[model samples]
Target: MAETTNDTATLDCLIAGGGYVGLSVAVAVKHAAPHMNVLVVDAAPEDALSTDERASAIAAAASRMLGQLGLWEDMLKEAQPINEMIVTDSRTTDPVRPVFLTFGDVNEESNEPFAHMVPNKVLVGALRGKAKEVGVTILHGETVDDFITSDPTSEITLGSGKKLRTRLLIAADGVRSSLRDKAGIRTVHWDYDQMGLVTTVSHERPHHGRAEEHFLPGGPFATLPLPDKDGKHRSSLVWTEPTANAKRLMEAGDFTFELELESRFGHKLGEISVAGPRKAFPLGLTLARDFIRHRFALVGDAAHGIHPIAGQGLNLGFKDAAALAQTIVEADRLGLDIGMETVLERYQLWRRFDTVQMGLVTDMLNRLFSNDITPLRMVRSFGLGLVDRMPGIKKMFIDQAAGRAGTNPALLNGEAI
Candidate 1:
C-alpha cells in the first residue's frame, strides 16, 4: 500500500475509490484549477487496471471530456466507434430476430458517432497517466475507514490508521459506498432480480462498427462492437438473464455455455467463440437520497446506480464528475470555499433531474421488455416501430443518447473547465 505519514495540511479535495469516475474527478479538477491539491484513495491494488477485462461504452459527451483531458488521442488508438445500432425484440428461441429500431450515423452533422466501445484498461491507464502528470496523488490498496466533517474541513482516517484533512471529501466508492453510509446518506435501492453476464467473443466476420441489442424475455442481450485482433473479428457481449439462470450459465462447461450463447447471439456474426473470462454482476437501481452533506459529496455509482438497459451507467458517472469539477472550479475562481453547501448544491441541482429521468427510463424499459407477456410485447414492439418510423423523433432520441440533450458542462462540451 502507498503510505503517507499523517499530515496537518488540508487538501482541496479527497476522493475515495479511484475507479474511472474518481480518477476523472481528480484529473478534471486539477486541469481546471491547477493549484488545488487532490488525492485519490482506492482499495484496489496498484495493478488492478491491468486485470480489468471489461469494456465500457463511452458516450459522445464522455469522449469529448476525455479529449479535453488530453487522453482521447491515445484512447482513440484503442477505441471502436459505434457507427450503427440495431434494436430487436424477440424470444431466445426465436427463429428470426427482426430489427425494430435502428440508429446509423444518426448525427451526420456533428460527424460524431453516438458512442465508442473502449477497453476498460485502455481508458483507466490513460486517466491514471493524466492524473499523474497533473500532480494528483493516487494511493492504491488503501481505504478511508472513517471520516468526520467539521467546521472548515473534513478529517479522514485510513484503514492503516493514518489521518488526513481535506476541505471536501468525494465518494466515488461505487454502488455500496462505505463513505456514503458513513456520512449517513440514505439510498433508494431495489434489485432488478436479474444479472448481467459479460464476456468478449471472437467471430468469423467483422461487426463493422455495428452494435446490436436483442431484447429477450430475460432482458436485453447486447452485442457491442470492438476492434478486431490478428484478423479476427471481436465484440463484447452483455447477456442478461434471471439470477438463477445466469449462475447456471456461468457454472456451465465452456462448450455448454457456448451452445447457449450461440442461440441468442445468432449466426449473423458467423461462428463465434468466447475470447475471455465470463463474469456476472447483479442488476439493480440505487439512488442516493441526497448528493451532498456538509463537507461531503457523492459521485458516480456512489450517487446513483441505475439499470444498464440503456448502457448509460458509466456516462452518467462521467456527467457527475464533469458537473462537480465545474462547480468546484467556478466556486474557487470566485474566492469562495469550494466545499460549502451552496457550491455543492449547484452540482446536485444540475445533475438530479437528469439522473432521476434516466433511472425511471431504464427501470421502465427493463420491466416492459424483460418479460414475455403477450400484450406487453405487442405494445413495446409497436412503440419501437413507431419510434423507428419518426425521423425527427429518432434523431432527437439519438442526440439524447449521445449526451447532447439538456444542459451540459463545459468539460462535456470538450472545453476546459
Candidate 2:
C-alpha cells in the first residue's frame, strides 16, 4: 500500500534485514527456485562475523525443514540436541518441593529430541553460504533508505545509492521493522516488566543434553546445553527476571553474580561458572495486524514477535521463511505474479494462526509465572503435575514440540521448508 522508489530492474523478492529471518527467507526461496533473483539488503557492517555468541533454539519442526534444505547436516556439527526438558517452579522452596516435569518422545517418533541449540552466528553462516550456492545475491552494509511498489514491480533504494527491483518484497527486518512501519502496517505490542538475561556458563558435570526451564518468580530461567571448550560441559542461559533485577545482575561482579546463579542452577550442572558476557533483551510481544498488502508481505519477527519462554522465537521465524518460500514457489509454478495478492494472502493465512497461538501461550506462561501469587502458583504447578501424569495430555505437548499437533505449514513439517 505504501510507495517505494521505482528502480529500472526488479527482483523476485527483496528482503530487508540480514538477520536469521531475512537470510532464511532468501535461502528458502532460492532453494525452491534458483532462477528467481533474490537479494538481501542488510545494514550490519561488513565486518560482522558469522559466529555471533547469541544463542537460539531451533524447534524440531524447524530442524526438519533444515534437513530438507540440506542445512541440518551443516548445522549438526555445531548444534546441541535437547533430548529431554526439565521444568520446575523454582520460586517456591517448599519441602514438598516443586515438581520436576520431563517431556519425552512418542511412538514412531524415534524418541528424538525436542529441539537443538544453534548459536546465531553459525546458523546465519550456514544460511548465507547456502544462499550463495543457490545463486541468491546478498548486499551487506547496505541499509534500506526507502522502498515502494506500484503494480508490476517493487523497488528498493539502499543507503549505498544502489537499487534493485523485485516481483515481491518481504519484510523480515524484526520487531522494530522499519519496512513494516513504513508500509503503514499496525503492530500490537506490549512489553512485560521483565528482561531476559542471556549468557553462557561452564559446568562441572555433563548436561546430558537436557534443557532445563526454571519458572522463577520473576520469569523463566532456561539453561540449554552447549559444547565445552576444555572437556567441561557448558550451557547457554536465558534467565528472565525483573528489569531492575536484571540491571543489578548485569552490573554485579561476575564472581558475585555467578554465586546467585549457582544457587538456582547448581544441582544439575554441579558447580557453574559464567562462560560468556551477559546480554539482556526486554521481553515483549509484537503482532502485525496485517501481514500482506499490495505487492508486499512480512515474515519472521516483522510479522509477529512473541515471548521466548518456550524458545520458539526463531523457530517461528523459520516457519515463516519456509511457508513464504512455498507460497512463492507455487505461484511461480502457476505462472502468477510472485507479488500477487492471492499468493501473499496464502502465506498470511498459514502463519497467522501459528504466530497468534504461540503468542497467546507464551504470554500466558509469562504472566502466570511472573508473580508470587500463592493460589496461581499452586494451580500452575499442579497443572504441570497433572499433565505429566496424563499420557494423552503430555503427548499433546510432545506432538506440538515435534511440530505435529497443530495445523502448520508443510515446510515446518519437513516437507519443503
| Window of ten residues with lowest summed lDDT in model 2 | 1-10
lDDT values, one for every candidate: 0.92, 0.80
Tens digits of per-residue lDDT for model 2, 216-308: 787888889886667778899988888898899999998889888876675655777887778888878899998998789998888988878
lDDT of 1 at 239: 90
Query: Poorest 10 consecutive residues of model 1 by lDDT?
Result: 1-10
lDDT of 1 by residue, 150-236 (tens): 878989998888888999999999999989999899989999889999999999998999999999999999999999877889999
Q: Give candidate 2 regions above 4 Å deviation.
A: 1-7, 92-97
Top model by lDDT, which number?
A: 1
lDDT comparing candidate 2 with the true structure: 0.80
What is the Cα-based lDDT of residue 120 in candidate 1? 97
TM-score of 1: 0.98
Error of 2 at 338 (Å): 1.3
* TM-score of every prediction relative to native: 0.98, 0.94
